[model samples]
Target: MESPLKNFAEVARKFCAWAETQPVSTENEVKTAIELLANLSSAILATSNLGFGEDLEGERISDEEWRVTYNRFGFLPFNYYSTFFNPANVGKEEPVIGDLADDLADIYRDLKAGFWLYDRGHVKEAVWEWRQSFQTHWGRHATGALYALHAWSTNESIQL
Candidate 1:
């Protein structure tokens, strides 16, 4: 039996691969990808609070590579309303456009980092890194991406 961490890692890996290669030519394709991401995000958060530890060696893909893959989804129009990252003090929600390709890439970048560590056999580091980043960062992007994808699929006639 696979460990929970490995199971989650596999899901992350598969999602990344699928996202990168999946067809976006039709609404059905996009909806399927969105569903995969939403489920992945939920599963990630479910186990995020279950551990604590130091991270091991890990690496990130080149920014160029990230942007390149991000560009592949350029054909997609991933638009959503974004809140100001630091609006609590202002007490005003400044709305902005959130791009799904960019946001999805952001989430995938973090997941790839975790995947890197796990692939290299640093299991503890992978889980720690994933949990910490999920809590601190990519979780927002993942959720936002899901929302944008869903809204796009359900209401293609409307842009949010």
Candidate 2:
């Protein structure tokens, strides 16, 4: 079975290749490609939360469930909104998972900004933002980050 990262990379690569072969004069194709790129970013951002899975009964656990579990286990930064929203918990523990969650949110926001720039024909700015997003959070994995970097470098629709 292929990893989700591999799947995302393959799809992104194919989209870039398709975008390059498309005529820039075709507004519809360009729009479609840009949308696909945005969707790709969203997919990657969503996958950043690595550990939740559905139960045997097919019920998925809520974020609160996982948050509380992590908190009970003495995980640092136990102030996740789903579990504890108290302001007092702010400086308690410095859990790496919590930090990663924050990074995941930033990834989504940056991806949206990049896609908007691309849609508006600011390709260079879009590429720069996308590159920034990847650089900021890419340390979590080897393959996914490398593939994303390759896609960014080779995609003509992405300037800079």
Candidate 3:
């Protein structure tokens, strides 16, 4: 089996490339979005399968970097949105503008932090940080983005 860290890093790289190059309103927008969502989802599963060694915090930015910019309508024709699911409001809906750029950017930012540590020979820190952020942050973004992309692909409403 491939190392989870490597798999995650590769996914991050591919996502970055896609975000940077994917044009607006492509003919196969749905297909591209589906593929991107699949990669992000796989990275999340890989994170879950990996162990949380050392339980240490990796380097984090006090202020996050700028949001990743991308072709807004490149992945989907319409703007997408979703919100955190609360058990108390299981049936209620709160929709925000959930663009693909923001979704990919969230995943990229967390992945970059871990990859930075890994590149600097802090392997343990990298894995620990990646897995931790996966649970607390990026994982939710991936899932939400998946919901949006899948809905777009199927011509259905974005259901959270």
Instruction: Give TM per candidate.
Output: 0.80, 0.28, 0.69
- Per residue, candidate 2 scores C-alpha lDDT tens digits across 112-152 of 45455555655455445545455564323222322343343
lDDT of 3 by residue, 64-135 (tens): 342334333334565556555652575586645656666666676677778777778777778777777777
TM-score of 2: 0.28
Writing each residue's lDDT as its tens digit, candidate 1 over 27-143 gives 655665577777777677666444555536468878997897687666565544565565464856666677777877777788888888877877778888888888788877777
Our model 1 lands, by Cα RMSD against the true structure, at 3.5
Best by TM-score: 1
lDDT of 3 at 59: 58
Which regions in candidate 3 have their CA more than 4 angstroms from the true location?
Answer: 22-29, 47-65, 68-76, 82-84, 92-99, 156-160
Assess each prediction's global lDDT (C-alpha) against the native. 0.72, 0.41, 0.64
Candidate 2: lDDT over CA atoms?
0.41
Clashing pairs in 3: none
Ranking by lDDT: 1, 3, 2
Model 2 bad stretches (over 4 Å): 1-101, 137-160
Higher-scoring candidate on lDDT, 1 or 3? 1
| Number of clashes found in candidate 1 | 0
